[model samples]
Target: MKLHQLEALVASADAGSIRGAARSLGLSQAAVTRALRELEANERLPLLIRAPEGITFTEHGKVLLTHARIVLNQLEHAHNDLERLRGRVEGSLTVGVTPWITLTFLAEAVRLFRERMPDIRLELVEGLMAVAQPLLRDGSMDFAVGQLQPGASELEFASEAVLTYESSVMVREGHRKVRARSIRELLDEDWVLNFAPDGKRDLVDYLFTRHGAQIDERRIVRAQSVATLQTMVEQADMCTWSPTILSHVPPFGGRLRSLALREAFEPRQLGIVTRRNSTLSRAAVAFIDCLLQVIRRHARSAKKEDLALFKTLELLI
Candidate 1:
């Protein structure tokens, strides 16, 4: 079938109606219906069902749609590969990052990269390391920045030391625990827990659990979002464990005070992770190098105040 026909079917499945799909594809309703019929004929199976409410994809249609997307992506990659062969770095790069890192070094890295290489497209997906790992393996993400974990032998990954930092109790400006530098004083308070499979979550949970002062898992508010967690900590008395890196920047360092946790939560390793075997485009490689340079610069300029901010993120270079 034609690419347009494939796109039509996929769009129809996504939109759930010919009219909606037509709008999405910038085609007339009759044109969309014609394309759907052509695709159905080419596949030798019905692709959509028309009902009172709207249209729905048939089982065969769903499978075809999945393959269609893969095929389209391959075509785009082919085009990009040709562009690369011409020694032109002009395609998009998508990087997955955790929220705290997004608020910290990523902004600087993006700014420097854009200034240096204006032609390379950029995209960012911010989330937990657990969620980002699979995408890295699937080749969806070009690279990521997360904790250096134990299982590097299995994946194509390269890591660099970013920073080292300890855990601290974080609360809104006026929260009572903000004044208490001891874990005991903060234990009873509800915590906005950061619990994921990565080192940050693991180390924080390990310390609290071992100390017999684990935040009430039942009362715990599991906020995977950095912005949400920050907002929750700011609006309510709920406390969160943070890396000292956050204290490096203003508003972040100045707005929230991280009282030292009494328990010895070991310093977590923070770093940049990139696929080892993957052939990075020149643009992507350049961006990564620029990011490493930025990390080095930040490290040399690391002031006591910055470490306080870096502590919030465990940022090291």
Candidate 2:
């Protein structure tokens, strides 16, 4: 119905009670109750159930609440967009980024953005695509930068390929399997996984299965952080898979070496992801421009051989 009515529904759903919603909305409890009652009357449906414990949504209420949240969120984005158009530096932006992207072009892009809009608040979340999609869908995050596998879902998202990298099998400097060239050669050694659940099939699992073989699950070790994964690979007889680019970064390069395994995922590249058909805020457009700028600059300054295969991703003028 009305915007205030939608606000009351969303706030009540989030806070779980009219009193709590009133406090959050900075309105009186009577005001919140009235808004909720009016919203129910307008829709001719009961949206909430009040109990001793808390508030619960009915079936129709649940469906309507989802739309209500989006409306309010889009309204806020609209306000922020207009503020930017008026040359006002107000409102915050949230972006999801994966590890390597954060460590690479993000630093430079953020520098450029901060110089242009110093007062805008920024939130950078780190995780894989699985963790980012829900936030992206709900408008919590404006966009994300991460690896984009082929055949990824396209109905709700769009991708612009930014950088492509070769893949590598990494091991410690003097590890016994450093010379191993085939997938079968390294299946027996201990392995470490260094990413959160990405919902899709993982590199190691896919690698083995592609060759009609499998890695013993018992030999697989889970390491959540880069430091842990590197430490294990460096000090112990273990190995891991990574994008070939990581092997060139300073500290990581010194800790491990890429095995000469002839394996790589097709489209071993990174891209910018956003919700399809959504209008991005002005700040988001500016930040993404910087992202593309950084990628272009990198393609120019980087060694010729290193980016030789990335011709498709790096569209320089």
| lDDT values, one for every candidate | 0.70, 0.77
Candidate 1's C-alpha runs over 4 A off are 1-81, 148-161, 179-182, 197-205, 274-277, 302-317
What TM-score, computed on C-alpha atoms, does each candidate reach? 0.68, 0.82
Please give, for residues 1-317, the per-residue lDDT of candidate 1 as tens digits: 89999878777877888888999999999999999898898879988889878898788877777667655545665677689779875787777776666766778889899997787778888876666666565556767777645665236566666666555667777777666856767667777866555455555556576677655556567787777787888787787777655544545666777676556666776666665555565666777778777766666576765454543343443
lDDT of 2 by residue, 78-168 (tens): 9988887888879888888977667567799899999977888989988767677777776678889875433555787888776665666
Candidate 2 ranges with C-alpha deviation above 4 Å: 33-66, 148-152, 194-205, 221-228, 231-237, 302-317
Error of 2 at 70 (Å): 3.2
